[model samples]
Target: MLFFSGKGGVGKSTVTAAMALLAAQQGKRVLVVDVDAKGNLTDLFEHEPVGFKPVEVHPGVHVMTMHTEESLQEYLRLNLRVPVLGRIGPLARALDFVATAAPGVKEILTVGKVCWEVRESIEGRADWDVVLVDAAATGHIVAQLGAPEAIRDLVSVGPVRAQTEWMSDLMHDPAVTALNVVTTPEEMPVNETIELVGRVRSELQVPLGAVIVNRVLPELFTHADEETFEAMRDPAAVNRLVDALGGGPDVARGTTAVLDAARMAVSLRRTRAGHLAELRRAVDLPTLFLPYLFVREHGLRVTRMVAEALGEELGL
Candidate 1:
């Protein structure tokens, strides 16, 4: 089981989907679970609305959206062995009220469902070869994954405590679970990723698989290229280039645009390099970099490209 998480807009869902595709390509029976409310994974595959039940999007990839309420109901049915309670309206509403009133209860239900799926089996064989979870943003994912311990502290004995302990075991077991934190090479996101790594290692005790750095800007201008441009920055060279293009306002504007674009690219690359250096210093996990996609929009084609790139990075 792998949980993908990062701050919002860091392309967490996109990376999760790409990894799922790569896993499927490797002949693993993969189930991609979306715990984020946005449900972007559904849109990525152009699938119909996903609910609690798993829907097969590709030949070997199945997708599902995990609703907290539905997960609570399933938990009740499984633990209480009362199927009708899960379907009954009043019982469901009452359980929802309790989940809402209690802190981390809903999180436990959500994450517990994921843990259950990871340990699920048929005839002594695992049901799926792997489970990929597109989890919520950093803060929420921390709270959610920490729910088992929180509830364990609150409820000392009973089924709730027992179940939470079981979930915690599965979560902290290095052989069964791994976490991947995604982030862009930006100030706030990289800082958050660093803090998240510390907490996951210290507080959660979960083994981290990797840090995925997404949407990195390529280094287009080397130091030599910058020096060359700096030498041509004089007014005489500018005028010569403009005159060579007919000396019109459009020519000057086009030249300025090209220079501005190059400058911007260089600035972005430098900033990202600094952030990458910080990540290397602070994070102790394997770091994988994915270049920014220049496509008009992200779709299956782009997803496959990212998956292929990621597979290469992982030597798969």
Candidate 2:
């Protein structure tokens, strides 16, 4: 299972969707699970409202939005071996109360469901080549993924303990699971990612797969362009350019706007480069870069372009 997580607004959903598409393109049965309540994956696929059941968004790519209530009911139905209880009202409400009252119980149900999928297969063949979880942001992801271990420690001798133990093993096994931390090449996002890597390594003991740098700005200015900009800082150079462009107030204003935009672009690129360098120095993981999409709105077409670029980057 490949779990993708990052700060909110880091475009982790887009990255997860793109990677799922790439996996499907490679003929893998891919399940893209959106654990976030925001249903960002639903938006990315432009699909009808996704419920508990898995919906095929692409050829071999299935998407599902995980809800805590549904996950709890499924967990009880499977573990208790009483399918009727999962549907009945009084039992369902009682189970919901227990899940809500207990901290991390809801999370355990959710993560346990994911682990169950990882361990299941059809006719000795793996059910899914990859289970890509578009998990919650960094603040809550560690707790969500660590739910099994927490429950295991608390419940020493019971069926719940046994279940959590299995889930924990699946998560901790380097061969079975890995985490991908996504971030933009910016200060706070990079800092949060670095911290998240540390926690995942030391606390969760999960294998770190890769650090994905999303929405990286393209470096458009050359060294000569920088020199030209420096020269344009002079009033004489600005006047000359305005005169060359038919010497009017409008021409002067246009020249100023163009220079300002160029300068802003250069500044932004430098900032992103510095953050990328810092991320490399601090986090010891393979870092993948995804370019910023310059579209008015993101849709299936743009997602495909991102998937193609990501495929090339990861050699998928």
Candidate 3:
């Protein structure tokens, strides 16, 4: 089970989707759990919004959107042997009310369901080669994942405790479960990712997977190439290049435009390099960088593009 979490807008869903695609390409059966509640991961696969039940979006890939209420329902039915709330009226609503006062109740519902699926896959009841989770944002993932431990602390003995024991067993085993954080090479995202890694190490039993740095701006030039760029930007060289391009009416303006873009690209890359360096210094985890994609839109096409890049990075 691979749980992907990161600061919002750091391409968490995109990275998870890409990994699903990558695993599928490797002929692995992947179950993608969209825990973000946006249900947007299915959109990338061009599928309609899904509920708690898993839906096959692509060949060898299935998706499910987490719904705590439904998760609770499934939990009750499976563990308590309750027949879809037949005995208890509005049990889900009751959970919502109880969740307001109880911290881990709601979180357990989500995380428990995720772990349950993983357990099924691991025990051969379900045929999932990989369970890739598009987990909650960084702000909530710690609480989300640590819910089982919290619940175990609060409830000393019960079916819940029994269930959480096995879940914790799966979580602490590095060979079975891993949590990966996705981030861009930017200030807030990198800071949050570093903080997250620290918190995960201190507070959670889940094993740390690689830090996937997304949207990393590519280095546009080497030292010698940079010197050449500087020389080309010299006014005389610019004038000569304009002359070489026929020096027509808008020749100088076009030359200036291209130079400005190249300058911005180099400047952005340098600034991002500092943040990447900070991440490397602070977080002692395997890091994978995905290049900033220059695209007009996102979908399976872009997802496949990212998957290809990710596959290459994973040496697939």
Q: Which stretches of candidate 3 lie over 4 Å from their true place?
A: 85-89
What is residue 253's positional error in candidate 2, in angstroms?
Answer: 1.7
Residue pairs with backbone overlap in model 2: none
For model 1, residues 133-249, the per-residue Cα lDDT tens digits are 998788877788899998888787898888887788888988988989999999989999999999887888667889999998887867898898866667788888889889999
| TM-score of candidate 3 relative to the true fold | 0.97
Tell me how far the alpha carbon of residue 138 in candidate 1 is from the true structure, in angstroms, after superposition: 0.9
lDDT of 2: 0.86
Q: How good is model 2 by TM-score?
A: 0.92
Q: Give lDDT per model, in order.
A: 0.85, 0.86, 0.91
Cα lDDT tens digits, model 3, 5-52, are 999999999999999999999999999999887878987887788888
lDDT of 1 at 304: 88
Worst 10 residues of 2 by lDDT: 119-128
Q: For model 1, where is the 10-residue window of minimal lDDT? A: 118-127
Return the TM-score for each candidate structure: 0.93, 0.92, 0.97
In model 3, which range of ten residues has the least summed lDDT?
84-93
